[model samples]
Target: MKKFLKVMLVCVMVLFAFTLVFGTSKKDEKEGIVIGFSNASVSNSWRVFMVANYEHEVTLHPEIAASYYTDADDKPEKQIADVDDLLVKGIDVLIISPAVQDAVNPAVEKAFDMGIPVIVFDRKVTTDKYTTFIETSNYEMGKAQGEWLAKELNGKGKIVAFSGVAGSGPAEDRWKGAQDAFSKYPGIEILGQQYTDWSPPKAKGVMEAFIQQFSQIDGIWADSGLMSWPALEALKEAGRPLVPSTGEQLNAYAKFVVKNNLRGFIYPFPAWMSRIAVQYAIKAAQGEKLPKYIEIPVDPIGPDEIADYVQMDKSDFWWVGDDQMPEEFLPSFD
Candidate 1:
């Protein structure tokens, strides 16, 4: 009986050891890749959506052992420090959306020098030291807005143009693109152009000033549709008639366009750009080949398609066509 009991205990111990080894092997398979994300800011709705998408994508991949994120609060100095800290984490890849067009280049170049795969998304640095870049074609977005406005105005109109944060890559590229397209229609005259800092209140103030000065404006051109609602509010407050406008893909703006029967064009920058950047980073970290530049398409949402993208129940801050994930995928800060 003693011999039989001892033999049974030995067999049980062997089985336990096998189970432990097998479980560890499975865990190891799920844990190894660490991805780092350095975001410019999450102060606004668009950025908040971007970060949520990044988190969602990381959750979907078991091979991604860990993920780290740093927000720069729209400050270049903070972003530089943030990237440095991420590099020290021994991350296999770094994804960055620069706060400043040129100020964040050194940190990006440093990460590239350290042999970590670098993916630059949304914004860009002055140098091309990163491994991959994913961004929408701002020029095309602006061009589409311009063409739509021209058609609505019958190729002639007095329009005011509003740009986003000055000197940013998207602002500069979109402004240039709008200029290029508008120049084609000699009859379309851009009356005044200003930077709104992508704030509705600021845009409202600017529009109010325009209303006080100009009595017969025919259209309003805003590179980022974010300013459209505020501009419309200003027009309403001044008791002016609705005119053709150009803006971005915010649901609130779209609903306003539909409700008021306004002639406008919406070009949206996909929040999924961050997800695409992560996908590329994971692939590059796994020693897979990647394209040097992945240009996200700039498809303008016309009036006919506005209803398809608008989420009326969502918060006013949400972007249109942000259907990459369901509503519950990310919490609404509201």
Candidate 2:
């Protein structure tokens, strides 16, 4: 009886060891990749949505192991330090959503030098040192927005443009694009162009000042969805003609598009492609290879198509109905 009991105990131990090895191997397979993520601070709604998007869809995948850093409030220096730290950790891939355009270039170049794959989302650096830049064509988007404005105004209007955060690539490109498009229309005149700092509050103040100065302001283009909302709010406060506008990723703008059927396009522009960043980082972690430029396309979301494509957010197309993610995929922030 004693020998039989001992044999039974040995059999149980053997089974336990087998189970442990199997579990470990499965875990190892799941944990095969690692990524380093550096993000700008989420002080505003746009960034908030971006961070939340990362947490929900990308990070939740077991195959993707991610180390994240935040440069709160768009601080360039902090972001650079975070990238260096990620490099020190030997992360397979580097993902950056810059706080500012040019300020974040050195860190990107450093990543390039280190032989790690780099993916920049949302905004672009002045230099082409990184691998795979996934950004919307801000210039072309601006051009389209400007063209829409000109046609809507019947080629004649006193327009005040709200240029978002100075020196940022989008700011320069979109502004140039808008101006370029407007230049084609001989009748439409841009009376004032103000630096909005991409802050809604600042844009509101600028809008107020523009309202007080310009007797008849017909068209105002705020490049960002956030800035656009504040501009409209200021115009409403001043009782301006509830003019048409454009934006990206702003729900309020979408609601307005639905309510008034505004003339606008949606740029699911990877404006800080928190999701794509995770994807590329994951690819690096999985040891899969990619190219230096994963150029993404920018789509125009006309107001009429909002209701139809509100669900089923196809990843290839960035925006749906002025909001970034499809309404179907919007995870609860709660």
Give the TM-scores of the predictions, in the order they appear: 0.87, 0.78
* Model 2 per-residue lDDT tens digits across residues 71-124: 535678888888888787666778787767899899999998888888887777
Candidate 1 residue pairs in backbone clash: 225-248
- Best prediction by lDDT: 1
Off by over 4 Å in 2: 1-31, 257-265, 270-272, 285-289, 303-334
> What is the model-wide C-alpha lDDT for candidate 2?
0.67
Query: Across residues 1-334, which tens digit of lDDT does each residue of candidate 1 receive?
Result: 2243234334433433443344345445665577778888764567666776776676677677767677786788999999999888677899998887888889999999999999998887779888988999877888888888888888998999998877677778888888998989999988899988777778899999999989988998898767877898789778999887877777778878888888778888898888899889889999998888899986677878777767888767777656577654553534
**TM-score between model 2 and native:** 0.78
Cα misplacement distance, residue 24 of candidate 1 (Å): 16
Best by TM-score: 1
Worst 10 residues of 2 by lDDT: 313-322
Q: Predicted candidate 1: what Cα RMSD to the true structure?
A: 12.7
